[model samples]
Target: MASPVDTPRNSPSPSPEPDNPYPVETVLTVPKFKRGWAKGARMAFFEARVPDYTSARAKGPAQTADYLVAVSNAYCQQFTWWLDPPNEPTASDLAKTDDELDPAELQLKAAKILRLRRASRNLLDRLSNSAPAISKMTPAQIKRDPVSSLISAIANGKTHVPRARTAYQLWSKSQFNKDIKTDVDQSVIDNGVDAKSGRIRLVTGSTQQAFQNLPASERRVWELQADAEKAANQEARGLQKKDGVIPAMPLDPTATQDMLDALVHKIDPLLQGISKLTNGNAHFYWAGPEPRRGGQINVISMHAGVDRMPIPCGFMEAGGSEGVARRRTVEAAIGDFALSCYDPKVQAARTLPKIAPCSAPPSFLRYRPTTWDAGNTESPSAHSQPSTDNGLISPPDVSLPGNPTTSSNQSPSATTSKKSSKKRKSNTDAAAPPAKRHATGVRTNTNDEDQTSDDEPEETPWQVDDDGSGEDEPANSQPRRSGTRTSMRISTKTLPPQHDPLDDITNTVHMSSSDKLPSPEIPDNVAGAQLTDDDTMNEGLDTLNAPTTPATASTPVSTAPFLSNPTIPADLPKYLTHVLPKFETLAEPAWQDVTKSFVKYEVSRKFDDVRLQTGNRPAAAVQWSRLRRPLITPDKLPREMPQTVKLAAEAFWRWWRHLQPSWRNVNASANALGDIDRNITEEDWERLDASGANGLVNVMGYLWLWGMKVGVSGEGCQDWEAALRDVQWALEKMTAATNV
Candidate 1:
């Protein structure tokens, strides 16, 4: 017998039919191997099953094409099985009877086996059709057979699963926000895989440019399609979105090659600016969907450290209707600012230097209000004892060495007597228990109201100035003696010297170790006198002194003042800096204006409102004129109105009036224009009413134009111009509708 490859070209076989031309089971010979067969025997068995396609080639080109198609289909079926193999039943599964097993499980198992059988038949069919399975064919065998070589190339080539149909359907349903069925059908034709060549058809430059000129909704369709495509491809390859291996956004037709390259160049500078503003605590990068490649500029923040993680900031798309991109950019910047406030690293960076200074007490030592000040002045003994106010313990009559009460003019005998008397009083106070002192309040008057009235003094409490400037004293020099004995003032006998007492205390407390002061003798009657050490007392006093130098020299006096500052960072992109300020002071109100404008434009443009046409005075315009009469007139514009806003409003009015020649009389009432018969469906009316008012759109439209004018300049100006042109085109369409 001749070898399979050397078989005669005209050998008799079943005639080929138009459909199901190649009978796979009849023509193919399955490879059979015994359990004990060696590797060589198995290899020879597979070689013997290889197909002879010489007979089909001898018939005609038509027959040959049919045969190739059948062979390709068979190979695909076999490859499917190789990708996912069927699971064999285990011993435990075999032990279960039909009744014991779940019907669903049994059905699933049978289905899997059926697929495996089909795969086996196809595997044999490929061998009969001059092509062995890819796994069985050697490199040398593949090169010898053209059919096998083609199959090998196809199997090994990059796998591009045609996901455009799935992607387009999902994208349209979620984001298209228009006639879903119509747009989906259109997208399949425009961006889907070519039927002839199983590959995505490249969009031509002219088609792309035309798409850029389309309406905002239509443009968004293409942009979303590109994003879906990239996401699908990434998922197929098990690639992460942040791998930075982003696919090019071919469907964003507005962003040309030059524009995309410019955006790429801008990334480093933009990120650098953000990093500088955040003090290296935050990092920005392009990521998400097709935004990384200029479909939309998604600026994501990552914590700037070893374990960097993605943070949801905001995104800006390059193309949209007028003011859309600018609005999105400003919103994104604001979102980043807000999110950064809660970020641990960001907050730490902002406050690290100020922590110690802000937390430390004020530099000047002064008396603060205590618990006794809250109308609880009733204790006599508590008032006479050394007060623990502000954590300082000093006897009532104990005066500093330099104080006038302890002046050098006093005789030594008199000073000794005063000191002896002070020691005796201290011993008596120490002998008294704390509980007795707290209980010894003036309870003679039991009436609650009388006690409150007597205790609550009309005059401010007396405060002694530690610096001896007497600035803390009340206007009346003579101290007011209140009926309540528990006044907040220190005894007059223990007045501080005419200088900063803290200075002397700090010197005495922080004295050199070698300069040991003599310890004073304690009386026998004083409790805990033996436990008190002068060194320990001095150490405790040291803590009372305020820090001479702040913990951080560079610490700001105020904390997080940026939270209140209206000014934006100068290092930010010029577009952001220019546009952000306009919305900064009136962000919420401006956003409301933008939303109203969008609704008004959509309603008027869709319904073809004749009142908004160039020749007719719109109701919005008349209302605007009436409203502006007081704030703006021929003589002067309101001072509160910005120059930019005034100029923008004026320019928009001039452009609106002259947009088209006015055949109608200038004196025609806006009410007359509204009276024109027009077919508006119930749904359309609902949509129109849902839009609320129209005047704000006209106001915001002018402001948006002014912002776009100033925000973008140079080469970057083209994008904004294209956006404005879209708005102009929509308005022109509305105008043409009226003429019709």
Candidate 2:
């Protein structure tokens, strides 16, 4: 079975459209820079696009360059300034007037054309610099060659070539294609020479012969140009034009390596440290919503992996948002992005966070509250005062919310008398049973009045032994609080609902009532076996009434009973060795079962029809749910299920899915190692748990179902052929179960 990851080395070539021999021209539209602040960058970019062009390679060497001159004239004539200069009325007579032109739009159009022309000049210059043969010629000599003009026009965006009709198509995979092979044979190409004109003219010849006439240096230049165009076309496939980012004003191509280094350090201080730590180079890069004028420019740490990948430090800049403000915003966003990468649960939405104004600290710098209880410490605040027997502190008398205000006419003596009376009432209420007062949700002694002083204990303190023993002793033998707080009656209606359908179906564990209770403390007297018979009986009764503790999730469960018994023979089957690795890894009985299951799945598959039924997904899902329920439900799981079995089962299930055939054979479709369909993308896999693809169950639930049937040790056991066969059988079973 071929997975989606298996892509064809050579994709089918698109059929060619009818060719137009004549020159085709269309109106070119230029867009205006809507942003006011990016005007400086825009102008700089346009200036960089203007070229100092020469016609060295455009004309013949001695008679001078008529063809080269014509090509240059044609290139310049496309722009408005060349056709209709503002300074000359004669030049403007045929051109669009000011009323017909948009100033911003016209300016942008000129800049774009200038940039494209400059790009072509740079390409030629680079080729000349690299080849000594070409370098020896002067700019004038090179520009006189007709080949240079045509190549430049293409790079400058003045001309376009359909990719399907490119000359390179005649060269690639030439060994496998006769047409491409014949196209490159120079001897075969010379047969078409026109005797009288001394010009080459051929019929039924390869497209590559058109370029074979050029000098070696010039031919190499055309090859490089075509290669670049081909690469751009490949990269643009399956992507929309809007997806691309036009980088902020590009750095000067003439800048020295050292200058770039200096620029990087100036922009980001953190990258300097990162470079030293990683023992790799650091450079500036950009990542944002887009690579246009307002896109973020940040320093990325480039360290060597199998290949180099930039590890960016959070830093960014936009138009008019440079210097300190951009750095801070980038830092904040990068912090969260880095931390999220470290988290195992943070797999959703892998796109980088967008930069914006931010005051929040990065993850590493953010304030985090310590969860440790301060009251447990040996500090003075922890044990300031001794607690009372009733667990109530009789506070100093204070005016209650219900009390009437003292009149202004009253003297200080009268106010003092009222406070004294309130104190007496508070003391009386404190003496009453705690159960009665707690039920009323009210206190006679006000909260402010009950505040303990710095010298008093707030909570009961444990006693340290005077003899310097390391252990703590019970403090003053105070009776400990125990049992459920039953005094206050809780309405059933007020309590949140207990039965959640998701939790029940997914087999999620919830804390039982007893699990929520505080563990009962054993008194020092009980440790010494000083409990009376009645005390022993009461303790036994409490233990009996307590809810059972749920099984520990980490503890390994054996899977022998659930799986078919392994068949361990004197000579083990080759497939068994592949899946199990070492025979000793599984017990004799378990190995037998592993062998048996493999045999069962393989032999049974031959009789089963393996037709794919994509539209019957609902029926397959229903059958899958029924099959998986026993393995997933905690109570119904086999007692012998072990961790090893679970891992092996998971690997097996994933391997099976990867073997499933693709439904659609598009360029973007490739199967993943564990995907049931070729359509699932990396993004879909990340959110598989959240998506209800399997109807009622999630990925975890499905894994758990298979996991309970088999277990093993180490990473995971795999049998490529076995898994493939199992998938074939599974598809058949699924179809039968669906009655399709």
Clashes of each: 2, 46
For candidate 1, write residues 350-413 as lDDT tens digits: 3322232122221111111122221235444332212222112221111221122222221111
Candidate 1 ranges beyond 4 A from true positions: 1-299, 302-706, 710-740
Per-residue lDDT for 629-681 in model 2, tens only? 21123223332232344333533343234323333222222122323333333
Return the TM-score for each candidate structure: 0.14, 0.16
Task: Give me the displacement of residue 11 in model 1, in angstroms.
Answer: 65
lDDT comparing candidate 1 with the true structure: 0.29
Point out where model 2 deviates above 4 Å. 1-289, 292-303, 306-740
Please list the C-alpha lDDT of all candidates, in the order they appear.
Answer: 0.29, 0.28
**What overall lDDT, based on C-alpha atoms, would model 2 receive against the true structure?**
0.28
